[model samples]
Target: MRKNSIKNIRVNEEVHRELSNIIRGEIKDPRINPMTSVVAVEVAPDLKTAKAYISVLGDEQSQKDTLAGLRSAEGFIRVKLAKSINLRNTPEIKFILDQSIEYGVNMSKKIDDVTKDIKED
Candidate 1:
């Protein structure tokens, strides 16, 4: 399938919605940080695997702990997905820490520093 094509977009949207609901309401794990958000979901064409990118609103340690919690609850999440979505096979879910927000913050800080140096000079 072509990247960013119509089909891929549809799959991504569906997976994202399902995952958001699962994380918010279904899974009852206490270890999962309450501030976690399902930033994006990428599903393969064959629908056998899904990469769920999560943006955690916390410091580095909190993010790491949240990821660990999600990883441990993968089986429970998959079971819920299988029952929730009508598919031949429920895709294996993989939790990934999405650092785009952090990257943006760092980039902005760098730009600010550069501007300050230029003004000083």
Candidate 2:
């Protein structure tokens, strides 16, 4: 199948949803921050592997711990995903730290500060 075909898109979305649910509600690892979120999921068209972008709302230590927790629970998460989604192959998941949300927030704050300075002047 083509990379951006409808079927591939659907698979990516389904995997994304299931992964979010599993990470947010299913996993009970203490290392994982309660504020963790699955920002995005990209499943290969071949359905053999997936990259899950994860965002943790915490300090560097918490983010590291969260990533470690997720990595350790990958097999369990894959099992849960397989049970929930009917796919020919359950993709191997790779967790990636995504700071886009945090970056955006910081940028917005900087812009606001600049605007406020202009208003004061």
**Candidate achieving the largest lDDT:** 2
| Backbone clash total, candidate 1 | 0
The clash count of every prediction, one per candidate, is 0, 0
Q: What digit string (tens of lDDT, one per residue) describes model 1 on residues 1-121? A: 7667898788778778888898888778777778889999988877799999999888999999889989998998988888877877688999999999889998999999999999999
Model 2, position 40: C-alpha lDDT score: 88
Per-candidate TM equals: 0.81, 0.98
State in Å the error of residue 61, model 2: 1.1
Candidate 1 yields a Cα-based lDDT of 0.87
- Alpha carbon lDDT at 119, candidate 2: 100
Model 2 deviation from the true structure expressed as Cα RMSD, one decimal place: 0.7
Using TM-score as the measure, which candidate wins?
A: 2
lDDT tens string, model 2, 1-121?
A: 8889999999999999999999999999999999999898889989999999999999999999999999999999999999999999999999999999999999999999999999999
> In candidate 1, which residue pairs get closer than 3 Å at backbone N, Cα or C atoms, i.e. clash?
none
Candidate 2, which segments miss by more than 4 Å at Cα? Answer: none
